[model samples]
Target: MASLWSKISATLPLNEEQFPLQFSNKVESSVVERLRQSRQQLYSNTTSTSRMLNAQIILDISWEKLNTGTWRDVDKEWRRVYSYGCLFKAAALCRENPSEDELLQAVRTCDMGLLMGAAIMDNILQDIVRILQCEVRKSVKEEDEGEHMQVKRRKTASPHVPSIKDGLAVPRIKCPSLESFNTNYLLPLKPVILEGIIDHWPALNTHPWSIDYLRSVAGCRTVPVEVGSRYTDEDWSQTLLTVNEFIDRYILNKSQISPDGVNDVGYLAQHQLFDQIPELKEDIRIPDYCSLGEGDEDDITVNAWFGPTGTVSPLHQDPQQNFLAQVVGSKYIRLYSPEDTDKLYPHQSQLLHNTSQVEVENPDTEHFPEFIKAPYLECVLQPGDVLFIPVKHWHYVRSLEVSFSVSFWWS
Candidate 1:
């Protein structure tokens, strides 16, 4: 326990010089004073309950400010305040004889702060959360190693049944030289399946992303999930849920399939999950191909897509170039050239301009007669395949089975 506390304490900022309590000049004096007082009370010997309550008050002030303004316009000081409040709350929860639930709460609080807080601040909470996660994993492993190992072995040996689709297939090639890829595919604005590229990823074999492994690493962390069918539906909406709850309610409940198809599909789509959880990030490498564009590696955006078999991404065009890598199961993908955009019947509303009104699988010909004329390239992207999609290329995707894919977007 002492060792654990030492590690936690080491992650905290050393002094006010490292992490000042002062607010910007525009902030009211009373609010700044309250923040200072809260910090002071945390420093002094006080009951953990009192510390947590005081931190909650600070968090409430930050939350109110966040709600009042557009995210981009929100004051940076409030983000810092929110982060500090979470740090204080986590510290209070970690001290003395904290229960397992309290420790887990501390980790979750820190993750929330990291997700929403200013990146410029001294983010000690990230390191603290990492430490707490490791501790929790250790404790959990000791208690359930035998059970989890059996599950992992069973899943690791399970055969992957490929989904073969017949259509005008995307051209395929082995790993190409950067020059060849840029000249033949990237510059020509063509979509192609580059095989044998991601086989070396740890996610492929070393730390195979089995359901049990993912649950062990990130099941407790909260993530936003898209519920209902695809986003084009009137009932489609997003809700925050723990990864474990999402897996159980959506992924594991195969019996809940409706007559038309799977109902209530919950998709964790286009989320920068690697930024929130570092453990999962270490399992995969950023493709070197992302550097072929104008931006460097840091400018690339990585997103995780995990959902059940029937999950669908309505036809849409993204602004940046994309490299969608299949990691777990197969996906049936169809791509239409930007030249055929008019035929696809894109939504006119500015909010949904990038999305198409036509459902590729069940298109209403009377409403969208031109959709039938659009030429397309299609493929079943198996695990270890990387499909390069050029900028503003309209594409539609449907998972053939339970799938997890990572996409890197860059310009």
Candidate 2:
């Protein structure tokens, strides 16, 4: 048991030697009691609707940021969050015949540990599922077996490939006056794929950013890279690597395939690479549409997203309106309106608050049944294509090939 906890702790973004997995009863009894009462109110001979209301009540407790800069920080903040999850799980086990509250409290207190951030793993999510125990979640998967099978078969589709679509086309344009773009799309929060807008950018013609070009330009620069199948995966980890080294291992090396027969992807996603490597800024131009914002051009933040084929940015929303420009290769993008937040089952964690818990490509219906009702718009962004994504819109992205994309974010 000790070894297993050690291994799990090692995977998390924390120093296990300093923050070892340990439990305390005296510290967490009160918090555990509150969680137990909340759980009992939810499951106690109540109608499903009533249970849902109580669950929402529990979730609605105001979550204030905790100061995690000292050893006292973990005890003051992280321990309570960890205990909250455990007690909620133990309460589920007493559903048939309610057990003594004190006995359950003792067990939950002994089982607690610290997780500094708001993120929780699949193992913890399973415990949360037991706590909420929503009825609709059970039927979600069985109801969509055919769709799941389709996603499984499509997983191996060639890189640069677009996912199967329902034939709805995203409006595309060659060029548009600033006035026209603002009125037709920007003001309405609608997405469009702009073409001629990026043709003049030096990235497309003046300089081809091949692997060699990237190495010569910013080879030694260190940047954060995400390693795993996707950010939503439990095994995902972020590491800093030089641009040259990242390209060599994840891109140039052929033996770095996963046991599942897919490439183990490393994505340099949403990084301010242009700022880090200023010379690289000369390669691209921001569109005139961003000028509609109140601030000057400097207010617009530029992010570089580079990755191998099969890399995915899971369903998530950004704070600013985004213009994602495809510089090198293609990408498959899906967008959902903010109105579908309820259906998307957003993660109940502060750090991941902007991210949806459901997997867009192959969502687990039993766990996120509401997702079945969320309508979405999708497009395949080809080289030089710029996609306008409104602020707070849920979007998912998958690289179709060895792709390099630059996104401009503005108010």
**How much does candidate 2 score in TM-score?**
0.60
Q: What is the lDDT of residue 105 in candidate 1?
A: 85
Best by lDDT: 1
- lDDT at 272 for candidate 2? 57
Question: Residue 175's C-alpha lDDT in candidate 1?
Answer: 93
Clash totals for all models, in order? 0, 4
Question: What clash count does candidate 2 reach?
Answer: 4
Tens digits of per-residue lDDT for model 2 on 1-411?
123223322433343233222335643555445554554543345554444343333333312223435545444434445444443333333333323332233233222221222333424423332222222123233543453344333323355455546755578887989988999999999988988898988788888776656754555445678888777777888886767668766765543344342456788875556754555788898889999877789889988899877778889999999999998878989999999899998889998989999878778999999898988889999898999999999999887777899998999
lDDT of 1 by residue, 98-205 (tens): 778887788778877887776534567777888888877776676556655654432212222334456688989999999999899999999999999889999998
Q: Model 1 lDDT vs. the true structure?
A: 0.82
